[model samples]
Each structure stands twice: as C-alpha cells, then as structure tokens.
Target: MLLVVAGAGAAGSVTFAAQAEPADPLAVYAARIVGDRARTRIVLEFDRKPEIAVRYIARPDRIVVDLPSTVFTFPEADLEARGLFRDIRYGSMDADSARLVLTADRPARLVASEVMANESGTGYRLVLDAEMVSQQDFEKLVNDQSWMTASVDATATAQRGDRVGQSEPAAPGAFVIAIDAGHGGIDAGATGAATKTQEKEITLAFAKALFDRLKGEPGIEAFLVREGDEFLSLSERVTIARQRGANLLISFHADTLRQSNIRGATVYTISDKASDRMAADLAERENLSDAVGGVSDTGEPAEVSDILLDLTRRETQAFSISMADSVVRSFEGQVALINNPHRYAGFRVLQAHDVPSILLELGFLSNKEDEKLLLDPAWRVKIADLLAAAIRRYRLPVVANGG
Candidate 1:
C-alpha cells in the first residue's frame, strides 16, 4: 500500500465521508522511506486519506505530523534507521488526535506533503517529500513559523512555576512527583537471561506500583511520564516532568550487566563526570533510549546563557543528590544494596535545569536472584513502599526550608 517515488510535484485536495457509527479507525497498512542524503520521501498507506497537519521544530530538528486518531499496525522494526531519518515515532497524542514525529540528522525542508487516492482507486496514501537545507535557511524556516514557537513557549511558561533558585509560594498540600518508566515500544531495553523478561516491562510494572502507592499518600500527586507502551524522547521525558511542575523526577530501570554476579539496587544523581565506570556505562546505555526507539539525535544547542540559569542548575543538582541519598538510606537493610549504593552520572533523563531528578536501578536482571525478586509481586510491593518512604523523607526538609 506504500510507495516511495523520486522527484516532486504539487498535490491536489481530497475529501472523505463522515462516519455514522463508532467502528475501526483509519489503519496504516504499509509504509516506506526512500532517497539518499540529499532528498527523502515518505509514503504511508491507509484505508482512506485522513486529515493531517505538519510542523517543524528546532533544537534537534524534527518534522511533526498531526493526524486524526488512527490505529497504527505497522511493524516496529520497519522504522529502524533509514534515509534522511535518524528515527521515527508515532502514537496517540490524546483521545481525538494522533502524532507521527520524524527526527532528522540535519536541517531539512518540507517540499511537499499530500494525501491522494491510489491509482487503483481502492485506498489512499500520504506522501511527504523533504530535502536538506543550509543552516541559515533552516533558521529562516523556524522564524517564519514564529507564531507556533510562541505558543509552545507560552505553554511551557504556564506549566513551570518559579524560576530556578527563586523561591515561590508553594501550592497548599500539593506535592507533584514525575515517575518515568524507562524503555518502551520498540526499545525493549535490557533482557533477563534467566526469565527472558525485558527491562521495559519490569520498569513499567514498578513505576505503576509506585504511582498507585503515592496516590494514596496525602498531599502527594504522582503521575507517569508514559502511561503505556509508547516511546518518548529523553528530552521529552525531562520536559514533561518540568511542565507538570514536578518537585522530584524519578526514573526507574532494571538493567543487566555483562557480569551476572553483580546485582543490587543503586541510585544515581546527575553529574558532569560519572562516579565510576559502571555508572558511566549505565548512563551511556540509558541515554541511547532515543536512538534505540528510532529517534535521530538532532543535537540540541545550548540554551541562552545567564548567571541565574547556572545558579538554578547547581541548586537543582544539589537537591537531586539529597534525594538520591535519602533513597539509599531508606533502602539500607530493607533491600540488597550495591557496594556504593549511591552514584553519580550524566543521565539525560535527569537534565532538567530546575527539577530535582534521580535514576534508580531496581536490580540486575542478569543475576538469577535479582531476576526472581524483580518478578515477585511481594518484592515489588516492598520496594515501592520503600521508595515512597524515601520521597516523604526528602520532601519534609525541602518543605520546611521552602526550597
């Protein structure tokens, strides 16, 4: 149902009939990407042409396609590294809308995009054409769409509270926590040798359990960055936490090491240099989530330079370290701990400049004992309780200090 052809041409308008009943939504049967470094074409076959809107975003340049809520049945492997694209991700944005995001390795310009009926007249296909452009031209494109950029900025400002280091009045009895369950959709993350379980599944299980426990606690409002099996860029994860005004961001994972003998829980705070070799390797693997999930690293440029921003980053990092210490202290004796227990690494998920964040490795799936414990419902409950306790302990002092 999908076809990719070279060259480009103008597109004609098309229309669809209204549905009377709730049935199956538009379905994508096939898709393909073609072309080389200069130009690229993308074709998506569907039961019928659906309404779609396209936009461009800078700072790791991307082309975003917004479509009516549709079901995607395409194989995950089909999206692996292809021409002009580092990665492609698509998922439901909400109840009535779906989104397809294409990450480009270089600045790209949209030549044409249109939905047209197949020549045979049975179905329709969405065709998109883009080509590389100079950095100056790309900057112009971004500026031409300044209105859209302003809207995005407004949304971010509304969501984020006080600027870094600037204390603001706290919301009465409100403590927001962002729980990120690492690796989802195409990125299965580490696999267990003994149980053949995937890290994504284990992280989601633990994250959900922790969310439920926190919801029951008074004055604590907790939510997951990802509610199901969907992919989110590393930057997106941090942005979501900050947008929701999260006081603390906790990323959960269960990774496997080459050496199966190493097994235990460990907590990591963000730092320029890793605390050890193991921590550095773990951070490297975790930071590759976007690439593993089929997203191209468009490379984000540094934000505007300011002394306030620098101070805010330092304060946030300090709070992150304090939170990590609390987690290690709470887990002591309650669960098996790694030698150091607490470490530091440059984890991308912990890079929000204003939010305190930490990455928690529940245990090693490579170890038989750790795998068994990770799969046990009873053990999960105990660990979730311990984490909630840690959060409570960290929150008390911050609330008292008006941090």
Candidate 2:
C-alpha cells in the first residue's frame, strides 16, 4: 500500500492510500465541495485510490466523473447547496460503475485532477480543481474532450447505439403518446406526508395505468419512456420521445408543496416564463430531477439558439397549451383540480422542440386529502381514465384529418 497526506492548509486534512490489496474493496468515506464561484475544488476521501475517468459536457455545462463501484458512506446533507456548482450528486450508475455529476451555474473548465496518498499515509484523497471560463472557451473545451477511451467496453457502446437506432417510425394516422413517469431510481421526487408514498412510485403507477388504458383505444398507440424504476436525464427523456416520433408527451408527477392546503391536480405546458410563482418553483424543482439522479444538468443553453429551432418550439408550445387545456376541461367534473389548473413554466422535460409535451401533477402529497387520494387504487384508475379521455379528445381531430 502506498500512503501520503494531503497538502498543508488544504480544504480537507485526510490521509489516503494510492492502492490497496486485490481482496479489499475501495470505499469512499467522505466527500465535499469547496471554493467560491470563480474556482471550485472537489475532495474525496477513500480507503484506497480509485480508478477515475473524467469528461465534460456542454449546454448548461457539467463535469462527469466515473469510478469503480464504490461504497459511499457520506451523509445526505453533504449534497446540499454548494459553491461553484448549482448542484451535485453521486451514486451507483450500474452494477460495476459509480458516477459523480456536478452541475455548473456557469461555464467551467477542469484545471487539475489527481488521486494522491495522504501525507499521514493512512488513506487516499481524490482532488479535482475547476475554474470558470468564457462561453467560447467552454464550448471549445467541450468539443475537445471525448468521454470515450481505449479502455471503454466495446459491448456497452454497441448496446447504446443499438438502443438509439432501434426506434421505429410511427404508423400513418396513429397517435403516438409518450408517457414519462417522473423521478426514478435515486431521485425519489416528492414524498407523501401521511402515507409516505414516493412521487416516483405514484407517477410510474399512473403512467402504466394510462398506457394500459390507451392501448385499448382504436387510433392511439402509447408507450412509457421508462418502464421500470430507472433514472433518465431530462434531455434523454425528450430525445426518446422525439426518436420514437411521439406526437404528444405526457409527464406524470405527484409533487409536494410547503403549503399543506395546496392540494389538487394541475396541468403544465412549457414556457420561457412561468405563469405564477408556484409554477416557477415547481418547474425549478422538476428540472432538478437530473441533478437529483446523479446526472449533470448539461441542458442546451437558451442563448445558443437557431431560428428554425425557435419556430419549431413556438409551434410545439401552442400544441402543448392546447393539450393542457384539454386535460383541464376533461378533469372539470371527473377529478379535483387546482384553481387555474392550466399553467406554463420552463420545464426541461417538456422541451422537445417538436413533440407537444405537458406535465400533469396528479396532486400535492403534502396535503392529507390528496395523499389519501393518490394512494387509493380506485382513484388512480379513475384519474388514468380521465387522462386517456383527454388524450383521445385532443388527438381525434388531428388523427382523423391525417395530421
């Protein structure tokens, strides 16, 4: 075993080892982010040196670090608001690989990264340093850095390619609906106050129910973007719907509010500006799903725009508003809805440019009544049927005329 101590007066004082015995598994005991907006340093304390790979992605900008399966013993509070980064998350990406994703509030570039033994020679420390950069410089860095390496597994690359290429075109006159169950895996979304039910479970249950209901409809073909408890980035969700040629995308969610009295279903369409403060807050929380799920929020930046993309987004926004209205109308008597149920916000999951997307908040889990209703099987089925009716109403005219 090779051992050393971190530099004097560093952010953290910890001993580390460069390597460990083959029989020993590497474990991360503590992790923290230090420094200000201009510069940021990430420090990780481990039982042994870890094999790490780093890469950068653009849009909202982020740095992704891949490591061997690690046993993380850090506290959840460690992931709270940090300097330099808007948010940070770390978790197991797969059976063999773990991932740490950091979201930068502005353009940032990795300055230095290395794993060294602590000076006291007890354990290992992984240090990463980054600094803010101009947009042009960040773009160049993103273009230059490649995630793929010679050590990358060939089978994994092929599998990813196969998944992307396997999308089939939608049939003529068929109304394809992409149901996105909000929050999964590490991102548990909201939790019910009384029932302790997770927002992810609620959304998945509703999405599956709606999918099944749509299957029996004549001209409708529906599928789930995620079928199981798996995490997907907001951008990936949009990409999947677009790749599958989905005409409409409905993201199901059960959000919570600090105000326990605010307890009703609501429909949301994408907009650059939110309709209300509550809507804005909800959108912000929903958009953080990627960060919550150990995925960096490297979304496409708003300033980097194209005329054609703007036009497409405008057209899609119109359709999305219409769909939101349809759902609100359908739920008028069948289900309880929040006042001014139809709202608009900049929801990242609903930004497919072409696919008309709406986020349906089933109810607020913070409310006792809403929590009870959300946990009821009968209520779920009723809500799913109502949503299916709304979709059919929205699609019938377009599909009948071959749109």
Quick one: best lDDT, which candidate?
1
Per-residue accuracy of model 2 over 299-350 as CA lDDT, tens digit each: 5645547898788678767777777778888889877778998887888777
Whole-model Cα lDDT per candidate?
A: 0.71, 0.69
Candidate 1 RMSD to the real structure: 11.1
lDDT of 1: 0.71
- What lDDT is reached at residue 237 by model 2? 72
- Leading candidate by TM-score: 2
Off by over 4 Å in 2: 1-50, 55-63, 68-88, 92-97, 102-164, 167-172, 195-197, 291-315
- Tell me the tens digit of each residue's lDDT in model 1 across 66-92: 676577788767555477878777754
Model 2 poorest ten-residue lDDT run = 1-10
lDDT of 1 at 133: 91
lDDT of 2 at 21: 23
